[model samples]
Target: MLTITDLSLQRGGVWLLQAVSLTVQPGQRVAIVGANGAGKSSLFQLLLGQLTPEQGSVALPGGCRIAHMAQEVKASDRSARDFVLDGDLDLRRMEAELADAEARGDDHAQARIHGELDIHEAWSASRRAETLLRGLGFSDYDIGRPVSAFSGGWRIRLNLAQALMRPSDLLLLDEPTNHLDLDACLWLENWLRRYPGTLLFISHDRDFMDRGATHLVHFDQQKLELYTGNYTAFEGQRSERLAQQQAGFERQQARIAEIQRFIDRFKAKATKARQAQSRVKALERMERIAPAHIDSPFSFEFPLSEKVSNPLLSIRNGQAGHGTAPILTGINLTLLPGSRIGLLGPNGAGKSTLMDGLRGEKTLLAGDRTCGEHLAIGYFAQHQLESLDLDASPFLHLQRLSPKASEQSIRNFLGGFDFHGDEALSAIRSFSGGEKARVALAIIAWQRPNLLLLDEPTNHLDLEMRQALTMALQNFEGAIVVVSHDRHLLRNTVDEFWLVNDGRVQEYEGDLEDYERWLADRRKDDTEAPRNNQVTSNGVPAEASAGEGVGESADDRKARKRAEAALRQKLSPYRKRQTGLEKEMDGLQQTLQTLEADLANPALYDADGQARLKELLGKQAEAKSRMEDIEAEWLEVSETVESLEAELAG
Candidate 1:
């Protein structure tokens, strides 16, 4: 357990965190959220005792240990295994002392050393160290590799493992998932979901917070508000709170108006002078909150480019590879201008290979590929960011990347991405993964390419940046082919998906969630299908089939067939309700858009129109409430159906 009482911190004469007080109890997951630099990291540092507050105190329970994983980690000239093993420095040293004493034939010294060694050899300590190392994605080979040889991302992971290895009662993690790939992030999510220790993590990963967090601690407007739920639940609660706050303020304003009217009518007559004075005093004493400013979603409209011919990029049975092995084969695909296509599959499902082919980097095995005339393309790779020189500062990196841009323009561009002041001068090597990703994005934006190929582009971007990028891409007139695992981002940004599987690509209409649901259904067939089908159980079949009845049994007329049919019938309504709910949500969104446009019109300033707008806002709230209820019902129904179906199939 840890408590902060009257905590305040200042940097560069500006109060970053002031008079913040909160208690973090054992077995609680607290998410520290704020606008980019609302002192989330500084608060974590204060709790970790790395930084002392300018005022107040941090009180920890007696004998409570704390561990912290900061956003950035420096790679040193040491093997990754050695770096993690170094977490037990005291134990290792003690063991060495014991070995030395035993070889010296000094019985008295050996007796003392044995007691020290016994304390260091605790089973809990070893188990925790092993768990931390493995949870952070260090295999046997990785454990032995020198830290110097590892990429900056791997070094960050190693540092995280080392910090977590400490026997800490409370863990403070700052943006822990920024450097992690999909596989490692999933492992970490599962691990943290069941972790017993108190966790106070600062992250921009909405999905991770939705799964791992039990409480949300929002630091905003020089105050902290605690919400008792995960991110989605917290979002709903925050919306309600803001609405109530606004309503209360409006009521107060109306009361003040009434007081003003009464004072104006009576005060001049001297019959209600005292009342007028009292009303004035009351107005002075009212501790009103400044009207809350809700951030509207980022608005973006890309400058439209001239229309180009169809088949922006054509791969006619293209064959692409590296060295003697082929990464992709028989890849016949065509990209069209203005298409927002999401490339889906696992990490090495040949998405990048196809991108390389489109970029015309490798030899096509036996087919022709063509690029449209006047096609200006931009390509982004997850590893491509590493090519930036670490020694260069952020400003220098940008200046070097685009020499034509003036210093003021470069600074302005960096500021748009939330990099300003000293941050712009910070060494590229010192930047967090999120910062680097922003730089990569800035580079892409500067080029103003007509076609964009992005691989895992959302990996290290913060929520706000992701939303901004989505807005930018949504408005861009050029074509975009993106490979990403972020379902939320992909769903919001992409118009369609190019499902890459089994050396071929299939087009699917709709958002990334559609692709995910389709994949989930396909995965169910692995165990249900014949052994010769070569389908894997994890949902990624060796070869994809185009149909809704992927894993459905072809023959089922047996003793349990009656039961199966009954289950299906029971599930049919829920499935139908789910479908109807999805359709209703779509229609509601369109209506909301129309109402929002009307409200934004300057002519709607009349009192009657304002009231009408307010009523529409209330309807929007009601629609949101209904949507949540429907989604919850659908989830419960689906879960029940799946459980029964799994049992019957077994």
Candidate 2:
């Protein structure tokens, strides 16, 4: 449980929060949302005790353990798994005590420490850390790698894994999905749903918030408003509220004008002077209602290219990779004037490789890539942000791109990205990540390219800018291929999906939901077997054999069948447990749905219904906690079943 009373915070003499108060009950997942520099992260800092509020108080239950994902990780030679395991301070402390006891030859203390470790289930700590890392897109090989070996983005993922590893009753995550791919994002959603604690996170990902958040804490006008439902529900409620506010504002304005007109018309007459003075006091006492304001600062569309080609780009029999060895082979792709494709695959797959090959950055080893005579490409990627000139303004950046373009036209274009006047001309060295990303996008948009290749273009963008980009992409009259974790953007912008996996590129004949299921099945299969290329003992390709018993003796085949049957018998209990957990989860989900519907009634939020509201909230939290337990049990049992199946097959 967490509570803030009359919280007021200021930074650089600017108020970020003014008289904001919120109470978050235990087992509630809250999504903190606002524009950039709107105090979302500042609130997190206040909770973490990194910053003190100028006034008011923040309270947490006594001795409650808190865990938060760090935005940065210091470079070190410690193994990644070790770094994650270190998050469990209790386990680490116990280990240290055990070592000391052993050095002193105190058998009694050593035995006591061993018992404590067993009670804490500390034996499985390493495996748990590994699971967290794998869910965040790290390969098994990466577990033993040093922290210093990972890039900045991967290090951020390491921080997330470390945060997840800690045992706590409160978890805080800020932009946890920023560095993750689609697979990792889905995995994290499931993980967070099963976190039986108070969850407070800030994310610009709409889909993520909808799936994970049970409550939304909105920051607007230096005030915090708590909504009892997910982002979609919050949107509906906010729309109604804004509409009512606007209407009230209009009515109030009309009444004030009427009062003022009467006062002006009668102020000179001696007989009506007293009445006019009374009207003036009434006008001054009237509380002015502020009009509702909701408008995005960004508005821009991709300009059409001057020249057009039927087939803008084509690649035939392409083999793309880092060096001599190819990661993706037999890739035949063609892009036309209106082609729009989204790439889908697991992490470390060939999606980026394919993008590089299509963009002509990676030379095809065994095939030819052809381009139209008038081909023009606009490519956007995270690394491109680093390529920007930090010393130059956004206007200057565009001007350098088109040396002959007029300054007025460039400024007008920059205005669409919310870079106005002095800000447009200021050097970008001190700009935030989102600002730099916008400048990169502005340059790409100004090129008027016929083809666009974007890879994770919305990494640092806020929700408003992401919506703007989605709108722009919808109206673009050019071929586009994008690789992004933002499902909303992919679903809205791309017309087709291409799957790049296992050294092959092919069209995926399914929607995003179907692709999600496909990924789940693939992960299940991967857990049953190694991902390395399958080969026989003699180094022959496994798939090259046509018959089932081509190289097996009758005794060996019978033995294998017997072993499989025994393994199935051994796995029956785990399968049963898994089934029971799933059933319990389904029942809890139904209960939660009913409770949410009941809570949606506007009457429950009124002044006379406080008791019922609190009661329903408590029930909701209880049901969610139960669901979390069931899901965790199900995951453990499912993993056991898969492992047994793998052993039987072997």
Task: List model 2 lDDT by residue over 1-650, tens digit each.
Answer: 89999999999999999998999999899999888999998888988899999999999987678889999999999989899999888789998997798799886676566655544556457768888888889987687779999999999999998988887888999999999999999988878887867899999998899899999999999999999988766766765676565665574475456545544653655643444454465346332311222456887888979998889999998899986779888989899987888999999888888888888875467688999988899999898888999999999999888999998999999999999999999999999999999999999899999999999989999987987797678678889999999987876566678998888989887777788888788663123211112245674444433435677998997786556555655665575577567657756876898899889888999999999999999999999999888888888898998898678545
Question: Which portions of model 2 miss their true places by more than 4 Å?
Answer: 244-293, 524-650
Residue 173, model 2: lDDT of 97
Residue 123 C-alpha lDDT in model 1 = 21
Candidate 1 residue-wise lDDT, 525-553, digit = tens: 11211111223355333343232244566
Which residue pairs of candidate 2 clash? none
Best by the lDDT measure: 2
RMSD of each: 25.2, 23.4
Which residue runs of candidate 1 sit more than 4 Å off their true CA positions?
Answer: 70-78, 88-94, 97-101, 104-141, 241-293, 296-298, 344-353, 362-367, 381-443, 446-448, 476-478, 495-650
Backbone clash tally (model 1): 8
